[model samples]
Every structure is written in structure tokens, then in C-alpha cells.
Target: MRVTGLASGIDIDEQVKKMMAAKRVPMDKMSQNKQLLEWRRESYRELNSAIADFRYNKLDKFRLANATNVFSSTVTGNKTAVTAEATLTANQVDMKVRVEKLATQTTATSPALADSTTSKTKLSELGAVGNADGKVILEVSRGTGTPIKLEFSKDDTIQSVLSKINANTDAKLNASFDEASKKLIIKSKDYGADPFTLNGEFDTGIMKTKTPEGNLQIGEPAKVFINGKEHNPAQNEMTINGVKLAFLEESGNEESVITTRPDGNNLIGTIKNFVASYNNLINTLNSKVGEQKYKDFPPLTSEQREKMNEDDIKKWEAKAKSGTLKNDGIINGALLQMRSLLWDTSTKVGNKNLDLSSIGITTGEYTEKGKLYIDEEKLQQAINNNPDEIAAMFGGTKEKDGLFQRMYDRLLTPLTSISNKAGTSRYSADPTLSFNEQSIMGKELTDLNSRMAAFSKKLKTTEDSFYRQFNAMERAINKFNMQSASLANFAGQ
Candidate 1:
């Protein structure tokens, strides 16, 4: 409906080309904005993940010696089972214990194939001598002795088959069933005892059989020793080495407290964490910066336009991009550190020999924010220079100020405090709004975290979509530009 770029007397091709050129800018703008949003979202994810990791790392591990309410495995009939501990530690004392037991097992056998040739047939075509609803009589032959007759009922299931077989047999042959394959098979007590067979015909058309798989026993209860001291073992309580621990089966139960073991090097984790995190951020950003628009779609939703605007999206994109010539000391220092090698050359390299630079981490040019990139080279240097620092940067290697540490302090402290509060009871027909300082603050922090996460995700998706659209627009514009020039040439001719 609108016509402005092309002259009124211009060729129709020229007009089309002009229209395309005009559309290009808006599409590009949309793509750029979308990419910015994606980056922001990814940043948010990295930040949140760091925070969660920090909080969990703060929880120190303890041995089963510190566990509570440990029960005895002997209560059910386990003799070899020793006292188990819930915590991971080196000392222990008196503690309660419990026995772990399982239900009894049963077994049943099927009639042997009369042909002895050992041919297989479909269940539908299988010859029958047993009824579907009644018990079937099967003759079990071990060696050359008179065969033992065993009766199996329809009520018997695969789980109970083993117990049933043991009850009826002193012979060496074992009877088993496979539920999954639906086949009846027999095995000899000793190896190479071939030709052990069962003789019985299925009376009903359904001659299908089943086999069962075996499972290992659950480990004995863990031990618990509290405060470098000893305590009686109770259910879920244990003393491992010398740490006190308890395994509360229920969620949010104060009684179910268990100490965790500490992994050395929090700082390294902090830094490398950002690597994975930043990669995710890049993915989100790429999507937004070049997304395609749904031509027929409506304008932005009300919520979409509220927190983020077109301009805000642009600003974020600018921040994400580094100028080719510009540099920041913090980012640069991090990069320089990454490039340097810390460990000496050694043929006997293990976890200690593992340097940061060995990986593809280096510094390079980043156009989006005009900042130096930690490309393969710089990345490796940074990792090699001080692997611990790099890891700590990403919330690894266990530092208090790492990304995860900050995130955890910012997000979880208030939440836990509020959740722990014992609030006053309010009695009213309509719920009275009595806001506790701790509760309110906790809720606020939680809300902020949720909002930030959602916003980041939305922004990333939008930007990614925008970039795709932008690429399409660029192609269209290029095509139109060529067409416009071609038209002018044609008109001249």
C-alpha cells in the first residue's frame, strides 16, 4: 500500500527492489534485538547455576558414624551384614542399626518339547497340554532317574517361581522362567549337564512362558557418629569413620539431616562453570539475533512489551558485543591468566598435569561487545596460567566469591531463613495479611530470581528467532538490490 523509494515513472522491478531494501532495516533491527535478548537470558542461566552450585558446595560431607536412627540388618536374618554408616567420615561410636530383607521367591516349570529336536514355534501355534485357567502337570527328568512330577498353577507368577522350584526339588536341575522373552528354559546344577528336560503338554492354546531377571541386595544401613563422638544407631542413622549422619526419608524434615563430603578446589569450579555457561549464552544469543518474524503474527503480547522494549534489547546487545579495539582489564586479565601455563612439562601427567591451555580456550576478537574473546588460544592460556583461577571463575575449585557463591548467597539465604520461620497463627474469616520480615524478604528474593530467569529465557529465544529472520531479510534485500540495478540497465537499453 505504501510507495516512496521508487520514482513514480520507475520500472516495476525497481519498485519491488526499493520495497525490499526498505524492509531490510527493520528485519535486521529485529534480529539484532532478538540476539541481545538471547545473550541476556543465557547470562541469567549461568548466574543462577553458579549460585545453586555455591550453596550445595557449602554443605560439608560427614561419615555414617554421625548418622541417626540406624537399624539392624540382622532383624530380618542377614548375618554377614555389618553396621552401615550414612555419613562419610573416619570415626564412629555406638549407633542403632537395621536389617535389610526381601520377600521370598518362587518358581515353576513348563513341559518339555516332545520332539527333543529343540525347535521353536510361535506361542499361537505351540502344541498345548495345559489349561489356561488350571494348573499343569510337568514331569522333570534329571539324568536317567525316574522323573519328578511338579504341578504349576496359573496363580503362580514369575517372582515366586524360584522358591517353588527349590521347594519341590532335591535334584541338581534348576527350573526358571523369563517374563520378557516369554520362554520356558532349564539349566543343570553343574556345567555341561545337557539334555535335562521337562515333559508335559500345554492343554490350552496359550503356551507362552516367562523368565525373570535377578537383582542385587540393597546395601546394609550406614553408620553415624556425632560430634566425633558415638551414638546408638537408629533407622537411617549411621557412623562412617567418625562423622554423625542421619537419612531422613521425608522431604523438608529437619530430622533427615545428612552431612556431605567436601571436594577440594572450589575456585576452579567457579571459573570453568562460566565456560559452559557462556557457551549456552552464545547459543541463546545466536538464536535471537537472526530470527525470522511470523509475517501474519500479531504484535507483541502485553507481557512481552512490559519488561523489555525494543531499545532495551538493543542496549543489551551492545553490551554483549566487544569492540575490536576496546579492552577491559578484568576480562583481559582473565584471558591473560587463561593463556599462561602453570604446570611443568611432564610425561607422567594425570589430574595434576591437566592444564587449562591443553583445552581449546584462548582469546580472540568479539565484535558484538567489542571485547577480546577467549578464543581457543587465549582460552588455553588462561586455563594453563592458573587452572584453579579459571575453574573458580566459573564457580569451580571452591572459592567463596565465585559466581555460584554469589548466586547462592543472593538467592537461597533469604529463602531458607523465611522457610525456617515459625509464624504466628492468624484467625480470621478472610486470611489476614501479616507479613513477617524474614518471610517477605525471602519471598521477594524468590520472586526476583524467577522473574530474572523467565526474562532471560524469553529474551534469548526472541533474539535467536530474530537473527534467522534477519538473515532471510538480508538475502531478500541483496536480491532486490541486484534486481533494481538490472532494471535500470534494462530501461537504459
Candidate 2:
């Protein structure tokens, strides 16, 4: 058995609840307005998204879908060779005069012992060179020892040439080679011979070097036009319509820096849009759930009035202050994702682990009372580190969720359900009718329109009765006043 919630003629809880409910009409209206604002925000977000997509795909012709292949290498030995794939826009390119060897080469080694002043050995004797197809025929000089004569078949590799030279002579000669760079320079076995000589010759791939080796290998530099301007990474420079960009090698994990200042104001536009959208959402939530100035409580509804109790109000207030709603799961989740993304990876150039907070996003403890807020400087730092990551955090499909979808469900679903149930139209009586009571397959519109006309007529009748009652009361008051004055005159007579 259950007791009635009412007590005597006045239920304190009910009366207080009625006051609360009366106060809450404003909240209900506020909720609708919030929904309207959210709808507007959504419209703007969609429009911006569409515009961005258009710019990236059609308008902004400078976007990079992919990057050109880059080549990097180093040569270790005196004679080295390197081969890599190449692609060029020009059908025919001038691939000559570019030296195959690196412009600058460096080597590090332990210092020679002080007691032993003997110089390190250097290789000197060099001869016969071959091309891509193996063929050997060349001349050599006997500088260190007796001049030696050697003969080898065309099928022999470059390695074979070195083997024959080492076997036939004791001139303190040594040879080492790297296959990557295709460089075959020789040195003397003695350290004092700073520059060893290679007097060799060959046909096809083999070219004679002017200094000592018969021929040096050189190729043309690769060139490209990016955004209608020439760019050569090997040259470490790019010229975009007379605006030159000198790219220094990336230091540490920092990205190679580039500048396009006057035209780079797009960042400002993007940030403004984000702020507008986020503020719109925040404002909507505030309007709906803000505390009342008079009682320091949020407005309640009719159903809430019926159920209000001291204990219940306290509990519900506690829930509002302490639970997910107060903390705002959507906002908290968005921020968390952003923070997680900022700290996810290391710098590309250097293996330095990073976090948003490191760059500037400083996050503190979050609570249900909406105390947590974004640190703009820290957020900007994180964005500077990785713009793509930040964008994805706010609007990515990784989780298949967003604030719009979540908030819409939370605030709209219950109201929609109530609206459907409270509808007095015949459309609501149909079991097959959807909760919204609007569909091509349903007769809901016809029923609702007819019901609305009847309700309007009844409202007019009630208004007319109120006016007639007011007129009647006015006439009675006037008649009583006139009769009172007549009685006073007769008494005086």
C-alpha cells in the first residue's frame, strides 16, 4: 500500500514543488531556445566543413596529396657506388656534370699511438675501368715499386681488378670499395700519401678522371615545379613565385620550418570558427541548466513538482553537481581526446616524445561543476606540433562519436517523447503513428489539423464567457452604488 503524497489542504512539499514548477517554465522554454541555438551552430559547422572540403579539393590548388620521393645516402670507402630509383616530369633530362660523390665527406678515427710514428697505409696504383657492362682495358703507373704488367678478361668485375693489382705488386697499395655511390677513387697505402692516384680507363660506364682516375661519374640535378615555382630539396631551397624558402635540416624533433606569412592567415580563420562553435555549445548548456537567482536552484518541471521532497531535491541536486551531467561528459571527452592526441607521438625528425602540456596545453583536474577549462596557450602549442591531430580529435571518426550527436540525444529525446505523449490529437491515438506523428504513410496531419481547429473554437468560447462575466459584475456594482445614494437622500428628507 502507498500513502498519498498530499497532506490536509496544504502539502508543504507540493506547494514548494508548485513554486519550483512555476519557476521551471522558463527552463523548459530555455531548453527549446538552446535547441534552436544548437541547430544554428550545427548548420554553421556543416557549412564550414563543406567550405573546407571545397577548398581542399577544388579551390586550394596548393594542397599536397603526396610528396616526391627523397634520396639520402653516404659513401664509406675510397671507391663507392650507390644506385637509386629516379622519376622526373621531363621526358628527357640533362643528367650530366653532377658529381656522383658527395660534396663534402668526413671520417673519424682514433689518433695514432705517439711511440709509433709510422704513417697509415694508402692505396695508389690504379688502372683499367669498366662501364655498366663489365669490360676492362686500361693503363697504370708503377710509382712505389717496379712497374707491373697485368692482363684480365672483360668478364671480370671491378673487384677483380683490385685483386689482380694487390696480388702482383708489393708497392704498399691497398683498395676498398662501396657499391652504392659508384665512386672508385684510389689512395696510397702509406698515410703520408694524402691523395692516392688511380690511372685507369674503360669504355661504356667507365669515364676517365682528369686528376688521376680515368673518368669521374657525375649526373644532373633533379628539378621540380611546386605551386608554379621551382623546388630542389637537394639544393635546400625553394622559390615560390619569387618568394624563396630556405629549408634547413630539421633540428631535433622540430619540423623543417617554412614561411608564407601574408597568405598564411588561414590559421586565424580556423581558430575563430572553432571558438565560435565551442562557445555556442557552452552557452546552450548554461542557459538550460543555470541556477535560479532567487533560490540558488535550477528550475524544476510539473512532474518534478509532484515528486519533490526534501530528501529527493537534495539527492537530485547532488547528482546534478557530482555526476557525469555536471562534469559534462561530452566536453570532458572532447578535451581528453585532444590531450591524448597531443602527447601521442614523438617528433618526426628526432625521436623526442611529446605532450600537449609540453607545448602549452596545461590541463588540471576536471569536476562536474564545470570547473575544467581549456588552456589556450598550451592548446596552441599542441596544435603547432600537429594540426592534423588536433582537427581529428575534435572531428574525427576514430570513435564514431561527437558532441552534437550525444547532446542531441540527451536533451531532445526525452522532450520529444513527452511531446508525443501529451498530444491530444487523434493522430496520437493511432498505434502505428510514429512518436513525432508526422509521416507520408500516416494520416496524422489531417487528424492534428482538425483537432487544432476544435481546440481553438473552445478557447474562443471560454474567452467570451470571461468577458460576459466581467460585464455583469460591473453592472451590479453600479446599481448598488445608485441605490445606496437614494436611501441616504430619503433618510435626510
lDDT of 1 by residue, 1-493 (tens): 4332232333444545455554444444454444443333333233333333333433111111111112121111222233333222222234332323211112233434334222233222334345554555556565688987766554444334445555664545455555444545445444321334445543222222322231211123223333334343433434454443343322221112222322222322323444454444333333333344333332343334577878965554354442311332322332233223112211113455433334343333554322212345554454445444444433332223433334333445322322233121121111233434344333444555565566556655665555445555656766888899999999999
lDDT accuracy of residue 161 in candidate 2: 53
Where in model 1 is the C-alpha error above 4 Å? 1-28, 46-133, 136-160, 163-493
lDDT of 1 at 248: 34
- Distance (Å) between predicted and true CA of 182, model 2? 62
Candidate 2, residue 447: how far the Cα is off, in Å: 7.9
Q: Taking the tens digit of each residue's C-alpha lDDT, what string does model 2 give over 83-187? A: 212211111221211122122111111111123212221111223344344434444444464343345455555576557656655434454343444444443
lDDT of 2 at 135: 37
Query: Each candidate's root-mean-square deviation in Å?
Result: 21.9, 28.1
How far out, in Å, is residue 418 in model 1? 20
